[model samples]
Target chain A: MNYPSKLIEQAVLEISKLPGIGKKTALRLALHLLKQNEQTVEGLTGALSRLKKETRYCERCHNLSDGPLCTVCASPSRQENVICVVAEVPDLIAIENTGQYRGTYHVLGGILSPMHGIGPEELQVASLLERVKSAGEEMEIIFALPSTMDGDTTSFYLMKLLKPFGVNISTVARGIPIGGELEYTDEVTLGRSILARVKYDFGG
Target chain B: MNYPSKLIEQAVLEISKLPGIGKKTALRLALHLLKQNEQTVEGLTGALSRLKKETRYCERCHNLSDGPLCTVCASPSRQENVICVVAEVPDLIAIENTGQYRGTYHVLGGILSPMHGIGPEELQVASLLERVKSAGEEMEIIFALPSTMDGDTTSFYLMKLLKPFGVNISTVARGIPIGGELEYTDEVTLGRSILARVKYDFGG
Candidate 1:
């Protein structure tokens, strides 16, 4: 980066590793930190360090957690009989924040991307199927995936497997404002999308 | 911020306090972390937590340092007779990276902004004056301040106080490209700017 000091360069490199932080933004961030008081700078650094140490992943749903299971998974009020399957933890959080959908969740970790070498085996689909089977006839699994091509592929694969178990299989409706991320959509749209869910029709 | 969780809201508030980061960027950052692997997310949080805890201000120059003096101040190779005065630690770093100059530095911490109630008393100008007065009668002072209004005012005030001391005073010459940042300038341009420096003279 042609930075003046090793420390500054190191800081810039670390910051640049962050998502969406380009070289310019990294330099700006490092410079911003340098401009602040020592306490402020140190506070941020300390928080970053602790984030690595204190946070954990929920073993049950693969979502971020403070302890063994995530807050959502552990909550008794949530409807465990209904599991909303999503591609990532952020989507789960977004869905939870809308105050709609009191169902529990299963984070798929990622969608099926054959080109990226991410197939059903690479994702948490097997675990989700197992969850459906283990949770017995009472459980219902809703595929709340993005309507992207890979997302649709993942849903089809999951639907084919879950059909034998006979647990209810549904998907959030497709008319969700083209190219919009459910995570960024407001509560009203997201709630409507959930309310307008459609049945999965596997080829007879 | 009306976040779904208390910890997420607190963390977002803290992260957004960094310069130029707003609510949207904070949310994006939080989501990015949520998407990353547990170890990466934890590492970032841990670093934030320890950022302030493990770092301290250099006793002499007030630059961020793990020890008493910053790396630059601690280096014995720098010219002891010439002290470059700058507004922030990042500015000092920018100069050091050129490798063309071997002078030490004094950070003013910030500029004088009376409109925002930032006066000379708020800056380290007094400390700088003290450092210069105690160093030596023959010591030279270089005003490597920015071309901003505040930088001009600061350098002007310092010149008056420093002139009576009879030390050779100078400033880095301009024409490096109007309004361009010293940090972003190529080494050749920065070197040329430093080489073209002229003696500081208040209009007699």
Candidate 2:
């Protein structure tokens, strides 16, 4: 598209670099920004700049943090004895939102995707191993990764590495989601559900 | 979504305020920015701030411009006597990209929409009328707007106001799009095509 100004073109170019945004969508966004008040634009830019400049990685869990450790890792109430492993900070947030898990988390940054040149070396695999081996107390490592091939591969690789440590390794359950219709459920999930069906028990 | 950090939450809130973007998409975009280098984020923010803070509108036609007059309006090669009126700058860009018209453009900024509380005063309608009335040369005004109700209403309103002036008035043609299949075309478009069919000449 022939943008009217260099500034608009530059802004559109930068915005379109985002994951799902395209040039047209970027142009729309830029035009919308142009229509907004100067303070709104300043606030947006300030927030983005602060987010990029002030953000840090948790030393222990590798989650996004404003300091050396993330909130979960810094919290005394969180259990370090059982660490739930996730692929990214958003996954950690998702698990935290469930409010059922009391354990600490280990963020792998991303799963192993060989096609994308993302392997164990590129991830936090070695650091995770070091954490597990050096811990004084027994820690149960739970793989909270997705059920995708990459997630399974990463979990298996970690499990193989941790076999000698004698620590309990587990994974989150895979089945049809609650309130999901049986007819609408995918075949893989349906098959897994049947294989891992729970025994029916009536209430007391 | 329950964001872990106040910075992330604020950034998400600001980003989500853009048209068509929602909280989840905003979170994804914010996290993507968090993972980028500081320079990339700075470039985006700088471009946005410059676009919002330094951008100006053309005094003659209300088009987005860096100076008092827009590039088209200031260009000597552009015909000032024939003006193509559009709802926004993007429409002007679209027409320019077509490479079919060499006339100047008058951007209305937006079409009339009473439902959204937009009226003639909210647009550049008065300025457009002043330009038409005070022009040193006779002019032909071509209305290039969407076929929406608001676009039609705004065009008709301007037409009625310009009736006293002997200046020629016209509208961009509307019918089936080029290379479009008749079978798959919508009913309104098909009916309009039949009503507005152009005269066909077999040979010159």
Candidate 3:
């Protein structure tokens, strides 16, 4: 489509480069921005630039942070001996939203996908091993990664690496989620759910 | 959801203020940007800020422009005697996409909508009238506004105002769109199509 102005065309092109945004949607968004107050546009651009320029990853856990340590890693109340390993910041956020885990997290950045040239070195695997080895007391490493092949590969690799260190290694349970219907569930998940069923305690 | 950093939170909040974007989509977009090269992010932010800061409206047509005149208004090939009146820049763009019109355009900024406290004075109605009055030769004014009640109201008011000027006025024809199924067409449009049917030229 012919744009009315070069500025508009450039802005739309830049915006459309984002994932899931098309040229039409980008044009719509640019027009929406043009219609808004000048201060709002300035604020949006300012925030975006600041985010890209200043944000850093936590030195300890590799999670996104404003400083060297993320809020989770810096908090003294969080259990230092327990670490929940996640793939990315969004995954960490998802687990944090549950409000159930008091333990800190170690973001691996991504799983070990050999097909994509993403190996253990591409992630924070070395830092995780270092953290587990240097600990004076017992450390529980919880694998909260996805149930995909890459996730399993990473988990198995970590298990072998930490075996000599005598650290307790565990993984998140995979089963039929609460409120899930059996009929709608996939065959593999349903079969695994049945095989991994826990004992029901009637008398408390 | 709990954001990993203040910068991410601010960026997501700013992005979500755009039309059709929600908090979840904003978060996803922010993360995508974070993973991109720093230069790409800088380019996007720079383009957006420049668009908001330097874009202008054409002095003659009120369409978006980099200078005093938009590209359409600046072109010498366009017919100066004919003017297609539209509500905004998007309408002009839609008409331009047809590649049929050779006439200039006059953007009214927006149609009169009393419900939204928009009046003739709030739009470019006076400027449009001034342009029509200043024309030395005979001119044709085409109404390409929407078919809604507000559009009709504006058209009727313009018709009354232009009666003394004695200029030829027309509107776009209403009919079933090309490739549209007759059965799925609305009754009002079908009736108008029947009433406004043109003669069939078999020899041509």
Candidate 4:
């Protein structure tokens, strides 16, 4: 599209570089910003600049952090011995929002994807191994990655490496989701759910 | 959602302030930006800041421009006596993209909307009248605004004000879109199309 102004065109080009935002949406966003006050635009730009320049990764888990450690890693109430291994910081946030797990997290940055040139070395495998090696007592490593082939491969590789450390390794359950209809569930997940079924308990 | 970093949270909050962008999409965009290099992030911020601070409106048409006149208004080939009146700069751009019209444009900035506290005083109505009055010869004023209640009200109000000036005032045609099926067409549009039917001509 022929933009009326060069500044607007440049802004639209830069905004369209983001994922899921096309040229039309980018134009809309730029126009909306133009209508806003200077202070509002400054606020957005300031936040984005600070987010990129100042944010760091947690030294222990590789999750995004403002300092050396993330809030989860710094919190004393979280169980340090149980580390939930996730593929990225967003996954860690998703699990944290559940508020069901008291364990700390280990963000691998990415899963093992040979197609994408991502191997075990591309992830935070060395740091995770060092973390487990330095532990004084037995630790638990839970695989909370996606249920994709890449996720399975990453988990298997990590399991083999952690076996020598004598740490207990487990994976999050895979089955029909709560409130999901059985008929609509994929065959593989349904079959796995059946095989992994536990005895029903009536006692509260 | 509980963000792992305060910077990420702040960025998300600011980004979500944009129209149509919710917290989840904001977080996704923030993470996407975090993954980009520093130079890429700088490019976006620079473009946005320049778009907000350096951009100006055309002196004649009120369209977005980097200088005193927008490209359309500054062009020598466009018909000076024929002005297409639009509600906003985007509408002007849309009409320009059609390549069918060779007339200049006058942007009203917004339509009449009493509910939103917008009126003739809030629009560029006075400037439009000044331009029409200053014209040395007969001129044509075409309304290309949306076919909404506010658009109709604004056009009606402008018509009454421009009638005394003796300019040939007109509006864009309202009809079913090309390639639209009559079976599913809305009743009002179909009825309007029937009433405003043009003469069929085979001698092209």
TM-score of each: 0.67, 0.90, 0.92, 0.96
Model 1 lDDT tens row, B1-204: 334344455556767887778976777686566556776765554444344335567777776776788776788987877888888876776787677888778888888777788888988888777887788548889989987788888889889988988888898877567788878998876886788776798997
Cα lDDT for residue A134, candidate 3: 86
User: What DockQ, between 0 and 1, does each candidate earn?
Assistant: 0.20, 0.68, 0.82, 0.90
CAPRI accuracy category, model 3: high
Best by DockQ: 4
- In terms of lDDT, the poorest run of 10 residues in model 3 chain A is A175-184
How many pairs of residues in model 1 come into backbone collision? Answer: 33
Best by TM-score: 4
Model 4 TM-score? 0.96
True contacts kept of each: 0.23, 0.73, 0.91, 0.92
Off by over 4 Å in 1: A1-13, A22-82, A98-104, A114-122, A134-141, A147-149, A167-170, A173-204, B1-10, B23-81, B98-102, B134-140, B167-204
What level of docking quality does candidate 4 show? Answer: high
> Across residues B74-96, which tens digit of lDDT does each residue of candidate 4 receive?
99999999999999888987888
Least lDDT summed over 10 consecutive residues: which range in candidate 4 chain A? A88-97
Sort candidate 1 into its docking category. Answer: incorrect
**Model 3's DockQ score:** 0.82
Task: Report the Cα lDDT for residue A2, model 3.
Answer: 93
